[model samples]
Target: MKKILLACSAGMSTSLLVAKMKEAAEKRGTEVEIWAVAQDKAPSEMKKADVLLIGPQMRFMKKKFAVVAEEVGIPLDVIDPVAYGRIDGEAVLNKAIELIGE
Candidate 1:
């Protein structure tokens, strides 16, 4: 299963998005592990994830995370603001799968 980790200010905001992503994954019959963590916890969590997606609000932290992501050898990107605002799980899930090259 692919692991997708989303990081935000406090992690709470992305909980719904994670749930939505899981639902999307279920619909697609894709085996995936999706979760959210506070930005402070992201580095450690990224070690266990196949990909790291930052919340749009935390987009500035991408540069900080890029180093660790590169060291961990995983794709990292900020969640699209438009999709995130709408909580479009399918779109986010598709982006994650594409990043994973699955």
Candidate 2:
């Protein structure tokens, strides 16, 4: 199973998105482990993740995270603001899958 990690200013904000992503994964019969954490926890979390997606509000942190993500050998990107604001789970899930190439 692929592991997708999401980071926001605070972990709480992404909980809903994580749930939605899980629902989207279920609908597509995809097995994935998705979770969210505060920006400070991201580096440790990324060690076990296949991909790291930063919440739009935390987009500025992407460059900082890029180095760690590269060391961990995982794809990392900022969640699209439009999709994130809309809480479009499938779009996010698709993006994760595309990043993982699975």
Candidate 3:
């Protein structure tokens, strides 16, 4: 199973998106593990994830997030604002696959 870690300012906003992504994965028969957490807690969460996706508000921290992900050989990226706000699960899942070379 693939693991995706979502990070936001306080982990509140992305929590909703997490549910949508999960449903999308389920409906599409994609075996993925998704979770949302505050940006500050990302380091601990990263250990368990195969990829790290950040929300629009947290895009500025992409460099920092990338650094951590690289250290552990995990891919990292910022989610598309359009897909994120609209909760476009298919697009988000596609993006994750692209980022991770799936």
Candidate 4:
């Protein structure tokens, strides 16, 4: 199963998106492990993730996350604000697949 980590300011708002993404993955018959974490905790969490997704609120952290992702040999991306605000699971799931080349 692919591992994905969602990073946000407090890890609260992204929890809902996490559920939506998981549901979308299930509907698409894809097996993945998804979790949400605070931005401050991302570095440690990245140790176990295959992909790192940052919420728009954490856009400033993208470069830092990219560096970490590169060092870990994983893909990193920022979620689309539209898809994120609307909790569009399908789009988010697609983004994940695209990032990991799955």
Candidate 5:
């Protein structure tokens, strides 16, 4: 299963989004592992992920994560504020697939 890892300031806010993404995946019958991680945990977590998405609030740190992502060989994208504000699970999932090509 493809793994999509999300990083936010504290991980709590994105938990709800993770739930929505899970539901969307379930509805589409997509077998993927999704989870949220605090920025502090990102370095360790990205190693296990196929793609990494950073919450809008954490966008400033994208460059930092980008380096780690490249080292880990995973595509990293910053979630659009609009999609994130709306909790657009399908859109985010599709974006992840588009980024990782899986």
Candidate 6:
């Protein structure tokens, strides 16, 4: 199974996106686990994920996250603001798969 993680400011904001992403995975018959975490907890959560996506609002920390992600061999990206604002789970899911070369 592929493990995908999403991080936002307080974690709560991404809850809806997480649900949508899960549904998209189910429909596609993809073996994936998706979860959202607060930015502060991201580093610890990274070890368990195959890919990590940060909310657009947290884009500033991408540089910092990129360094940590590189050390652990996981791809990281800032979610598109337009998709995020509209809660485009499929787009995010596709992005995650692309990032991990799925």
Per candidate, the number of residue pairs that clash is 0, 0, 0, 0, 0, 0
Residue-level lDDT tens digits of model 2 in 36-78 = 9999999999999999999999988989999999999999989
Determine which window of 10 residues in candidate 1 has minimal summed lDDT. 93-102
Ordered list by lDDT, greatest first: 1, 6, 2, 5, 4, 3
The Cα error of candidate 2 at residue 14, in Å, is 0.8
Candidates in order have lDDT scores of 0.96, 0.95, 0.88, 0.91, 0.93, 0.95
Could you tell me how far off, in angstroms, the CA of residue 33 lies in candidate 2 after the best superposition?
Answer: 0.4
RMSD of 6: 0.6
Residue 5 lDDT, candidate 1, scale 0-100: 98
Candidate 3 local lDDT, 50-91, one digit each (tens): 889999998999998888898888988899999998988778
Q: Give the C-alpha miss distance for residue 39 in model 4, angstroms.
A: 0.4
The alpha-carbon lDDT assigned to residue 62 of candidate 2 equals 89
lDDT of 1 by residue, 40-101 (tens): 99999999999999999998999999999999999999999999999999999999989988
Q: Which wins on TM-score, candidate 1 or candidate 6?
A: 1
TM-score of 2: 0.98
TM-score of each: 0.98, 0.98, 0.94, 0.96, 0.97, 0.98
What TM-score does model 3 achieve against the real structure? 0.94
Name the runs in model 1 displaced over 4 angstroms: none
Tell me which residue pairs clash in candidate 4.
Answer: none
> On residues 1-102, what C-alpha lDDT tens digit does candidate 6 reach at each position?
999999999999999999999999999899899999999999889989999999999999999899889989999999999999999999999999999996
List the candidate 2 regions with Cα displacement exceeding 4 Å.
none
